[model samples]
Target: MRNWESFLRGLLISLVALVGCWLVAGPTAHAATSAPQTPTSPPTSILGINLTGGFTQQPIDSNVISGHSVTLSAKGTRNILETATNPLGSRKYVWWESTDGGSTYQQVGTNSTTYTFTAPEVTKDTPLMFQCEYDFTGLGLFYNEWSRIATVTVTPDRVPTTDIQVSADSNTLYNGESTTVHATLTPDNATDPVTWTSSNPSLASVDAYGNVTAANTSSTMDGTANDHGTVTITGTSNGRSDSTKITVGALQNVTVNEGSDATFTLNNLPDGMTVANWYKVDDGTTTALNSTASSYTVSKTTVGGDNGTAYYATLNYTVNGSTKTVNTNAALLTVNKSGLLSLTAVPNFNFGSTDVASVSQDNTTLENLDEATSGSNYDGNDNGELSVMDSRETGGDWTLTASLSPFALSDGDTGQLSAVILDLYDPTARLDENIPATNTATKIYTSSDYDGQTFDVTDSQLSFAADPKITAGDYQSTVTWTLSVAPS
Candidate 1:
């Protein structure tokens, strides 16, 4: 009873003392107005990168030969390249290389919009990882947080490509244009190499690969009456050689717009040579047209096949009373790309203000373009975008072509940039982004490509040098962008 009484007395004394102190301290320091707490923003960028999915296209997986280098590219999600308000496309690219299969990365490149890396020094079985990032340093905004990990695998060099054979997509190559000389090697895994060389380089030239391009000239080739003559292209591998006879001439592929009447005809045929029959080849099957006339016309309604459906004729000629058959070169059929296809946008190339530069400048470049804005004219810090929309209403292989018109002076002056050419290279296109398996083509300049879908050439490398000694004035030119339907 005594202990309880003492505890109660002590508690009563403590409460009385606390009340006395609070009365003296004027509301116990909890009184008076407190300042409002302003909320701070989360973040606009992380380490100079907008991590909210800022990249539209990133580098993909690639397989390269042992000694070759692979270029990994990334495109930002922005519509335009650069502006006063936008520091996104200021061309600050850093490439990270991961040799241990993307576990850790090391900095490798700080070059242009694209980054390149040579082959790995280690075993190439594991795929290497590369990610391109845009670093803005002290700038408040960021362009790309990180890019898609571009996986690269280096293939074995070669087992010595033995036993090779060569063939051509077209027996006759048109001047200034090109045709692929498809080469087939035995053993499938044989990788030595098949070197292609032209006997008459003046008539035609063959590249390291088997692409044969004839010389461009208004004059007929070979001094033959029909503008047809053969150039020997030999492919050699391991002491074995296969020769392909490609007739170099001015045989333009037949283009039929919107299934219009396309007459399969040849001009300037020899007097003694007569056409035996016109063969329509489809899917490795051949059928005779049965008409022995010099030409055959395909009706508009009959043009239901794919573009580049071949129509070739066999000529029957008497050599010393023995009738022999010789097949003439193939003429590829093409349907017109009108309503079925359209070139929705073409971003003009602006070389910007330049001092008279004749020192051979391939360094001229344009920033990457993602979505093309309407009337989007890209200056030196420009966006050169080429877009094609294929509706699949009707058409052939959807092809988009661009040509540079002559430089016309803004002051109504007449002269030439003269041999100064602005070449657009390294254009990329995806047939359908919705379909992940569809191919992404890098060569969109003049190839028979794309169909039944829409896509954009996000970035095209544009470059040239102005004549150093030329007159100084503001000069402008228009790029002629054309759309056609041809088969691949």
Candidate 2:
């Protein structure tokens, strides 16, 4: 009996300890599995913006002029976590303009990279400023800083309103000459077209474009006399008119000796005559010469052609409230030739430095100073003759040869250039005669038959051809010319 009681007491103590432990662990596990987890914050967002592209604050003077249109552009860029992304879908742009410095602003444009606006006209100089604002609407709506200010100036259009004046490019003109007249309006924006008129259409005529042409006249032929007349030109604009007078005068006569310098003078010129001009006329072709004074000296070349070559002089002067361009009579030039054959030296030809794979040519002309005669007419049998003999006394019909020597350029390198050739043209044959690369004296020119009379001949055009492969340094060659009797 004593052993059974001891066993029951031990079993009871063990059951109580097991029950306590089970109760504590069940509640702790339940609390852990059923409780709500701590809520996490949403992913942070990083937004960035900028104003770029063609945005600049330039000087007012450098901008477009008034009454003109200008375009302003702005570029917007966005990034997420410092990485570039498209901002077009989430952003908008607004452009503003300020005409009064920065005191006030007006919305000029929006939602575009470019805005075209016409500059307003002003009485005085004005400044215009433009800026752009970017609006961000993604995630949350926000605004970006204003873009750089672009400034320009609008200059006033000063149209002529009063004291309208008219002027002319030239106040005087000779017969068959023209002058241009222009009107000055008070304001630059004046739209009135100027009407032009001539006091005497028989003396001078005015065109719609303000061009005035002097009429033809038959005047005196004395060496110092001129036919003088006046014509008034009027320019009318906005019911206002201005008039200018133009004077016309006759030409005088002059005489000169052949192969001698001749002086042409306009004596008894009208008062206020300050400018003088001289011209040479040959075969209906006119050539202007440098002669500012009342007198001009004719050169030997000018008096070397035919015996009856003529020249004229024009005097610019103001007379009786009018400006006039009066012409002098035809100045007859007499050329006296001793019937001798003469030649003028030709200038040296320089091809200049060239690179490889290129071709170069030099054109030179030879002049014949002999006078033209019946026998030696331009197209006659005894026209003219030219012959070349080798300097080394090479006999017979000689030929011209070319030899290119090796040269050193500025780089201190030496090389030989080749394929050099010479070309001569025959006026009678109307063909080109090319000289071969051989050392022979060539007769470049020879008449078909020789006549006793020597006449002025046309120029001979000589050309030298050089191959690009020739060394770059300065290369020189010698050509010898000798005059010989014509071959029978």
Candidate closest to the true structure, highest lDDT? 1
| Model 2: per-residue Cα lDDT over 1-488, one tens digit each | 77898898888899888767644543121111111122121111111111122211211112334677666555544423212333333656667777667666677677886677787776676777766655454432232435556565566653334545777665655454455566666554354456789888776787755656665533433222222346788888778888888764333234443334666555544344554678777666677787777766665432325445556676665433456565555554554433323232322333334444443343222232234432111232223443221212222332222232222243446653454444544455453455433445655454322211122223433233464345445544433444454332
| Residue-by-residue lDDT tens digits, candidate 1, 1-488 | 99999999999999999867644643122112222212122211111222233443445554556766666765543312223344433445567777676666777776455777676544434467777665443222433345657667676664556687888766765444455565666755454556789888876787754656666543221122232356899988777889888876433356755435777666555456677888776655677889898788876412245455766676776543567675654555677554545565555544445555532333333343444332222332134445454535443565555455555567778754544344344323443111111122223344343343223334443344444446667666655556776753
Once fitted onto the true fold, the runs of candidate 2 whose alpha carbons sit more than 4 angstroms away are 1-263, 266-271, 281-291, 297-306, 356-416, 425-431, 436-439, 447-472, 485-488
Off by over 4 Å in 1: 1-117, 122-153, 156-158, 220-227, 251-264, 267-488
**Candidate 1, residue 472: lDDT:** 65
Residue-level lDDT for 478 in candidate 1:
59
lDDT of each: 0.53, 0.48
Model 1 accuracy (lDDT, Cα): 0.53
Q: Model 2, residue 358: displacement in angstroms?
A: 6.7
